[model samples]
Target: MIMAYLEAKGAKNVRIVPLDADNEKLVKGDFPSLGKTVEVAIAAHGSSTGFKSLMNGKADIWASSRSVKEKEVLAAKGFSDLEDPESEHVLGIDGLAIVVNPRNNVTQLSKEQLGLIYSGQVSNWSELGGPDMTISLFARDENSGTWDSFKNMVLGKQFQLSGSAQRFESSENLVRNVLQNEGGIGFIGMAFVGKSKLLAISDGPAQAFKPSQLTVATEDYALSRRLFFYTHGQPSNEYVTEFMRFAQGINGQSIVRNEGFISQNVESMDASLADDMPADYVEMVKGAKRLSVNFRFQEGSAQLDNKALKDIQRLAFYMREQMPNSKLLLIGFGDKRKNEHRSKLLSKLRAMAVKRELSRLGIYPQKTTGYGDFNPVASFEGASKIKNRRVEVWLR
Candidate 1:
């Protein structure tokens, strides 16, 4: 779904292909649309396999819906060999599912019940008040990306499947069989639940409910899954990077929701000046274009007061997640041109202070520079210079 979303965003040359880190005989691009062109290879496997392909250099974009694990990070022996090895990007979330046959009336199942179901201890449908027949089970294939994810989450080292359970090649295939067969249930990505009857699994009434963009957004849905699309460090091509930027934009998420997953609600504000940015002005600047705007700060200081911090934090969060490439120029000013020269070094220190705080919060590899008080509001010279003795963050 995420790969499809990117294609909808004018990423004309985008392609989704299967990949294998250890073997390529069955790992070739077998999907029909992928054969349309081999312009660039993007291996959108389940998260683990996607990372594997990324580390192996077989793919440009590694598509999956989970955060990279330490185990997987250790698996990146080859990714560090990239020209620029630190390139990593996180896109959006996909709500995971515990699907069952439409005929099954069980609207919600607790986490304990789910553990039992997967463990094979709860084998009969009648145990959960459905049919008298034994509950047939299925999972993704051994080499499947989803299978790797499930193993890490539910099964782990101690996990095992019963003899009666069956496995399929893909989630799409699994959903097809689960829908047609009675008393059969399976777990799948939420996007696949479209057109098929799905049961809502919940932990409690006040918060528990069916999975949707809304439920998942509010964290009311227990099965919300984080979807991801990774790249090997950062791509060397501008188009590949541009396509990634498009994927994180509103259009990509719109496609994600339209394709049957949940949509992300992006926060926005109309700025009167350089106001309404996240508390980290320098970080927020990275996400902003070269739009001219005004910002008011404390009367005599560059320090961010409590009230100003609130607005900046909101803007900064969105910027960091959405714009990974842009850098912010954190220029500080003094009361006058005379003060500017002497304040230049001090201003530089102030900008570095902001960068340090943001980097501590995990916004890495951003640059910051300071220019002393040369630019000020002409209308309010005295009062504004006091305000001008402030940090003016802008996009470069």
Candidate 2:
């Protein structure tokens, strides 16, 4: 969608050539801009295929719905660490929404329950407090990044998808299948939910949250994930570099929001203290409104990840233009720790890290606080623990 928008408005005398009649696989276009004609080709395959193409010198960028895997990084011969911030670019945010037929009474589920359903353990809707109908599973193909993310985030290593589950290459088709089947369940990108009913998902002890623009943007939703576009290190191609710059700018973010994904643009909304929240933490944010962006760090470190670094710049821009005089509060949370004091201190340090970054941009926050091991967004069992370590911004 971003590419199509750019081709229409940012370029002149555009020419499009489809490799196939459907134009679903390969496309080449000549976009005239800035006194030059830049030729660009896009191959719309599965995410794994994109990485394979990049490794084989067939593509300059790898568009993916999930993060690069360790094995893929090791396989790229000449590419710098694909996990590096320079190589990994977060395009936008998406939530993997569990959808079912609109007539289904089941409206919410725990992560564990979802795992069971997909693994074929809970094969009947009655098993989940729903109608007495046999459940049918629908899933993305093996090569799709959507499948990869769902496998890692929901299924995990303990369970594999049921052999009888139907696989789809298209999100729309999967949603359609679920819509037609009364007992069918499928996971899809939030944007593709269509007429299917969405289920609120809870992880660990956190409250259930449905995939929404705000929840996905804040990454509070259980299945929220980042969409990415990876380049070989810093992108040697001039056109690729220029396109990336445009995609990360304000106009590009607008296109992202318009296309039903959550853009990185900073926004604020009034929030009330929840009853389940800790009293002290609730008091801190009593009358404050929360921002759409959260500053999260790398695993086991205070260093901001690639997306958070970009968010700092976006937050700065937003503050200068919209809330120059607003008082900012930073609240940090951490995963469970054996030493309570150490956990609290570490959480505070994470907030301080964000403060320091914002300070460099001449945006000083008024207060920073830490709430260690309180209101975890995900379980502390595995890789999901990283989601618990984050700093949230609020306006007084």
Candidate 3:
């Protein structure tokens, strides 16, 4: 896309050489739209090789899935300081999805349980509420950035993957293998989750989260990580700088969206109950301060998602230590489901669900109300309708 856009702006003889460390071949097929003006040759190795290529002046750009490590930054001091300003650019965000065969009945797993499974401490499906069978493990090779990120996130950097686990050179192969085995479990980039069942993950049994653009952008998904493009210092070349800017700009972000990753430009926020709410709800929270967090539900369900579960812990602590005598107003909003009455009722039910969760945390709401289809963050038919179905917290 970037190449095409540049061609549209009338640049000539453009070429992009991308060295991929993930071992997957990058086939830069013909782009008739761009009139074949740009050439992209992708070399498969590991992220380390990309960095090596950059330092040795063999490649112009290092497309890395993971951030440049400290040791790597030191190695490229002569030619590039990857950490320097304008040298590193974030292209997109990807949610590392935990996938299983469609036949697997397990819909959720806690982070600790995931750690144990990958570490070889839990090898039986029965231990995790699955049918009695030996669990099959698939993983990315150690050379890949996906493997490094998974190890750092789930298994500590000091821990090694189970010896029994089968490792693949690419995410595509790992996902394919998992799909074929009923008891198979693995992790892959969200883009590779075709026809595979994605598991909702939680820190505990209380709440679980599935990866979505909203969730991943807000980092509600535990495994959400940023994708990067590293250049040698700040590129002084006109074509390189323009390409980098194009990738970081709105058009480039559109490409990121098209590629099945969360665009860096995607908006994510914990909006207060104060804005554009009903007059009554606004009055109720007139003198109150809004917490930096809000509650959200799973799609089509009244249950809180994993991020809300963690937010509850922080809110509880704040209430106990900072505002012992304060009162809370729980205001819920719903999308247009049916008629006005049904929308209103559904909204109330959502608020009540939040109240129940607060009760579990030993905190009680002084008042609660639901405003259905009232103030929407986006159009009802737009992709962001889910943002409207929420409960906001206000302290008085």
Candidate 4:
């Protein structure tokens, strides 16, 4: 898309700049060229970092395998508050291809295995291999957004860097390294596959096949990601804006398809997909608070009523996600009117109702306790209110 557009306009000296932090830093001593209408340089940096390069005037344009970040947008808006910034565009769609060398006959790996490998657990080729060799893992530098997506989606969470691994400065280098190594696995922008053999993960959510143009378009690619180039807004430069239109328009999309990544156009997700998730991720519907519940039983009866049981069931579901790992305390509120012996038993039943209901729902509480007619939240002339006569979920 870039080459064709530059040629059509008769623009000269256009180069695809691989804008990166180091590359940006290199231009600190650059002196303005004597006379040149256009100059393009290629940098091998991630998308957000590329955006930074453009904003800081490190390059005429930057290429990336990711999209503008939320923070980058705020930064662009901030820069826009100052002077004019270059125009932005969405380059062709690109995804990170989770690849293993052709020598690797593992056939497929579940998301879990993929996570384990990258997290440095299953470190040997023999662990899931044909040869008794160490599994050579390659990864991109932290500066790359492609690296971020892989770490987030594949690793699930971050920890101290794995003690054994190889890091490359460029995505191009990472892809090449993976292709050249046996029993080695790594990720690179799908565009950089070249002659490397790609493997498929069967029954994957994205698809049940290998990484291919068909898989990407048909929604079978597991490692699909978006490619983006961000700018403050449309630039004041006619040349830059015109290039942006071509890059953001249909032409750029064609390049994206040729590059081997799936476009969000054929992408199956929403923008707010992350919002439906929790801050810690993993969709733990449980929340933390400090509310109390009271369960009261009849003077002589140790049986729980329908209302109490219903509330217990609710608390069970609400707490189910946290069960087995989280603890629950069941406190029974006893009625002020109680017989000496029955008082203990009545309060005990109320507590039992809650614990049993939770158990029935497969929500395990670590322990159950009974507090007979004790620790009343509210009392009218020492009388218990039915509203206070129930099991409550206490979130910690």
* lDDT-better candidate, 2 vs 4: 2
State residue 163's C-alpha deviation in candidate 4, in Å. 2.3
lDDT score of model 1? 0.55
Overlapping backbone residue pairs in candidate 2 total 0
lDDT per residue as tens, model 2, 32-111: 43555555677766799899888888988899999999899888646678988889999899999999999999989999
Of the two candidates 3 and 4, the one with more favorable lDDT, higher being better, is 3
Could you tell me the C-alpha RMSD of candidate 1 in Å? 15.8
240-306 per-residue lDDT for model 4 (tens digits): 7777767644455556555555432221111112233334322222343323223334323555542
User: Count of backbone clashes for each model?
Assistant: 15, 0, 2, 12
TM-score of model 4 vs. true structure:
0.54
Best-first order by TM-score: 2, 3, 1, 4
Candidate 1: Cα lDDT at 230 = 60
Identify the runs in model 3 with alpha carbons over 4 angstroms from their true place: 10-38, 204-207, 268-396
**What is the C-alpha local distance difference test score of each model?**
0.55, 0.87, 0.73, 0.53
- After superposing candidate 1 on the true structure, give the runs of residues whose Cα lies further than 4 Å from its correct spot: 1-38, 42-45, 77-86, 156-159, 203-207, 267-396
TM-scores of all candidate predictions against the true structure: 0.56, 0.95, 0.63, 0.54
Top-lDDT candidate index:
2
Q: Global lDDT for candidate 4?
A: 0.53
- For all predictions, the C-alpha RMSD in Å is 15.8, 2.1, 14.6, 20.1
**Residues 221-299 of candidate 1: C-alpha lDDT, one tens digit per residue:** 4555556566666678776787776665567656666777654433332223234333554355545543121122444
Which prediction has the highest TM-score against the true structure? 2
